[model samples]
Target: MTLYGLVSSFYNQKAAVHAALRDNIDTRTALEELRVLVSQSNAYIAGRKNAKLAPNRMLLQSIALYLTDLLKTFGAIEGAEPIGFPVGTNGQNVDLESTVMPYLKVLSDFREGVRKIAREQKVTEVLSLCDMVRDETLPELGVRLEDHEGLPTVVKLVDRETLLKEKEEKKKMAKLAKMKIPPSEIFRSETDKYSTFDETGFPTHDADGKEISKGQTKKLRKLYEAQEKLYKEYLDSMQNGS
Candidate 1:
């Protein structure tokens, strides 16, 4: 299993033991499972280190050593006496659950620390990939790679012509944004070319979510007439570039 998967198994086993304690159930089975998972994680990291695996070997080893140190502090599992818990005020057994919770919390914090490191590693790798493409590949190919459908894992190449057209479209939108008109009005202007609106300038749609047409546009009430007026205005604006 991957280091991440190994770590998750250890954590899950620990949680199972905690839950067993909370429910006052027999914790023998859960404790056994926790020990087994921890042993497996240790073996996995040790084997990788011994063979000198190149990919993040130090990270795995460090995590394994850290876990070992924490478990040492843990003192022992259920089978051993005094499993890292202080006794009661009268020297009686204290709340085992409360006593043990702090150690588990430290383990949880360590897991989060590992997760933060993993995230940073991913971001660095992505930035390196971007730098490679931008500095080494873009000038050679004279084209840029864009992610397909907002998916970074899937990319499509964009030629100069397509890039220029996209830039021009962006410029047009920027100019439109600067115009002295409400955003709703600007959007309505674009829709007027393709849609039919009523006297209130609302789209000619009914409660059924379909366009409603009483009859031929000219023969109907102000609704159809308004649509015609909007269409004419749209055509004029397009021709005039207004």
Candidate 2:
């Protein structure tokens, strides 16, 4: 079943947490927090922004989330409470290749480790370590992890919309590519002829019948040249990528 389905049926975190622990041996508050953080951060990282989110932030969050889930599934966390958690005596196999399933292993490992530790429970310290791991490892993994299909439907929809918009833009550009515009000087000459029309009774010229200044003409020519260069470069890039 989908996570949303399970979440709705369960009606609360407690029920969902219970089910997550159902197949496992043990659970921990730290582990739960870490998992929840991973889930939340993944959504945040997946969200659209005016500017892209930093690559490091996205990678680190995915890795941390993946690791936490993997440990839990592996039954590795030590010093874990038995009441709310499930122990894995059946030795259920974990699939690391499965996009979302691999994270359970991270949770399992953490649980087993906590169980072995002789020290008392330290939620803050453990969470701090999780945060540190996330921060330290994000940069290294950000370059490697590709965005996957398990994202929210909204994200997927946005991606499709963006692609369609690009197609429309390309079509518009192609249409414009065939059109020819009169030279600026020709356009200005026509405008100047009409500038002295009988209706206004005021001279449109600033000082004389000058159409436009040399500097303005030069600036416009530079702008047009830059745009042409940019369009040529874009076409070359498309060819190369193809």
Candidate 3:
């Protein structure tokens, strides 16, 4: 039966117990009614053995709530001993604690069983979903997961924004490195003019065999140093963010 049906059946049983108590039934009869209620609860649980996990969870929670109401009802009967037994003929004090203890234990155990199952199911689902994402989704997108202490697995992106920034900084550094050793400004021969390849794959040269002029070289060196400093700053920023 569905959770709702089970809950409805339990509710009807509870109503019968309530009516039995109100009618001043004999202690034995009242006890029997209570026993029937407990049995009904257990039967509901047994019947759900093959049910889906979600419905089972809902059923257990509903049972717990209903059991709370039943406990309150049991508490209200005057001069009734624990387990709903009446005071004895000899006027001996009823063992209220002992009588109630067994029923309370049963209810507590039922609630705890439900809690344990729910917690285990939740953890299993979370771990399974995480595994699927790590194993199936990440690799296809060139992403990786990094495990860390006291933290979730971090997704490592090949083309993340910070990495892209670092790439751009490296490109700037390369330009600066090339600038530090400036090319010759004047070419003396065809060999000098054909020394370096241009964007069009044609050879070009600044100066044939000579190095750059001192003044121009000094200016380029200053620019290269400044660029290098900026690149270092960028690198530090990236490291700090990571």
Candidate 4:
């Protein structure tokens, strides 16, 4: 089996076993997480089919390694101690052959089939495969796989685009909010656009700069004037009373 095949199978088996044997553990949740990881791993491979990364084989290898690592972790956690598997065989004692092997074989078959189809078929096929494994096989294996409506996996697949768009939208909304409600200017501009005074006895004509509308400026001035008047009136009343 291919490395990808092996890795996917390893996790798939562990999840299945945990679901079967462990009554106390939330096997359903565990299976769902494993399924999502495998789905994402498969999607990565699908992307690498015609990806343009330099030394692209390294990319695929890296993904395979990541998958292997995840599977190894799962195997360790789930206590995938093999029963009849031979020792000194160099394979992990993680139910590698009996439970994981058949899943690997199925994945290999799917990969070969997809390879035969057009390059565009890669994503569609991988997604379809993920759905199939989650829906059909997980049920048969008595593992409860949650239906996130493919959202979690899609987020992983298109993470950059989605994250960038979300960031930009937040920035745009913040910009709009800033425009609606101005922030206090701590530092003045080098050349104050509103300043009419010119240095070095120069006659610098000023064009009208964009300022707060006349109505807003008037209201602010009125508010400050009212406050000052109220303070003065209060002082006068105190003096008279004294």
Candidate 5:
């Protein structure tokens, strides 16, 4: 079976065991089912000689270790002693408390060992596989995975702040491209162009190089007044923090 299929089967078995425990029903059937699944997973791993199957092997091993611990816990709850053996032996009297304490300690130690192995091997491989699958199926979702030293690979959220900044910059550039120049600047530019010469392309002044026509002088004055008025308004807007 596929790796995903195996993983899914493992979870289903685990949930069955939990349900049985929660309902105070017969857990023996659920436990047996879990054991069978674990064995099948291990058998599949054992047949694979490829290095690519290393993660799958680790996953199965972790599941087997966890199932073993779970079985031990159930045994401890139902047995006369935690070890599932009679209290007093053939030759010597076994202290009930002492026997139970050692069983508890062994159970605890085994559980801790399983946790360490799962963290180092099974969990990391699972996370890496999840990231790979996500990348293949949902690349447009902007989700990402990152690896860390001495830690599992983690899912990274989309960078909304950077995306927002890029969007805003595009909008600002578009607005600036179509923006109208202020009236004050337009007026000044027009005035400079007209002052260069008369409409006929001749110098405004004659041989005397004094004043030109009064009409021309009046037009120039009106142009200067209009420019000054707009310039003052622009300065006022700036001062007001517009």
Candidate 6:
């Protein structure tokens, strides 16, 4: 195939990977998707004789997250996987290629790495490191790993609704995690635009940042106000241990 054709094919495979990871339907499928992604990348990298690539540049939070009993049971952890990414002491951000799973944290990290590589047009270096991680990982899978299916999953795959709810919960937790724990420091609410009309009653902008009819502006503003009130109630309920 021509170099253009080869590169295009490689990226299409990576897109498939992003889709699979974003949905995170099941662990089995995610692994299979990553394996397929890595294979195409291998071919593309082999053809890149013009660039010198460092296969070890990609970093994972832990080898055990892939090759050991962590994914098997994730012992000691109850609901979520670990939250941090791997980075070099030199302060360079590392890739999450070894985090090949359907869990939220792993899936999100892996997806972001793919996005960054595609964004920077630096696929040659990153994809090569992913294949190296795959090489190190597959040996530990042994007979459980299959050619057509993928690794045997150790945990139940939550349904789409549950998964989405969990994703939202993860996001909420991330936002809340930034704040100092309760009662440590006073929290100051950020200013928010309530409507197209600012406090001065001047025609301003809506959420879409466009000027609209007064009627439509009031409608959207009321809707958003109700949402904020309901969300505040939800947070209050959680604080009260409801």
Q: Each model's TM-score?
A: 0.24, 0.25, 0.26, 0.20, 0.28, 0.23
Question: In model 2, where is the ten-residue run with the lowest total lDDT?
Answer: 150-159
| Candidate 1 wrongly placed segments (more than 4 Å) | 54-242
The segments of candidate 2 whose C-alpha lies over 4 angstroms from its true place after superposition are: 1-13, 26-211
Candidate 2 to truth, TM: 0.25
- What lDDT tens digits, residue by residue, belong to model 5 across residues 1-242? 56787788888888888787787666777777777786768656544423233446467666756665676676643333322233456755464545344554454345445546766776766555444444433234333333334333334334445544555686676544423344334333444333444543333553455546888757755655665566566567668987
Q: What is the Cα-based lDDT of residue 155 in candidate 2?
A: 13
Global fold similarity of model 4 (TM-score) = 0.20
Q: All candidates' lDDT scores?
A: 0.51, 0.43, 0.52, 0.46, 0.54, 0.44
- Per-residue lDDT of model 2, residues 10-94, tens digit only: 2444454556666563466535744664565455444523133333444444445545455656666432332122234457433
lDDT of 2: 0.43
On a 0 to 100 scale, what is the lDDT of residue 204 in model 4? 29
Candidate 6 global TM-score: 0.23
Mark the regions of model 5 whose C-alpha exceeds 4 Å error after superposition.
50-55, 76-242
Candidate 5 TM-score versus the reference: 0.28
lDDT of 4: 0.46
Tens-place lDDT per residue, model 6, 1-242, is: 33456446545644664576568545566557546545654554444422433222122222224322223342332323343233243555443322434453353356446745754895666756544333333333321111111222122222345545555686688656543233211111211432345443343564466766789658755655554565566678789987
For model 5, the local distance difference test gives 0.54
Candidate 1 per-residue lDDT, tens place, 38-144, comes to 67766775555455553345544554454444455445422222233333556465644455446544543454445457567766565565545543454353344
Q: After superposition, how far is residue 157 of candidate 6 from its true place, in Å?
A: 14
Report the Cα RMSD per candidate.
Answer: 24.5, 19.7, 26.8, 20.4, 28.5, 21.2
**Model 3 vs. true fold: TM:** 0.26
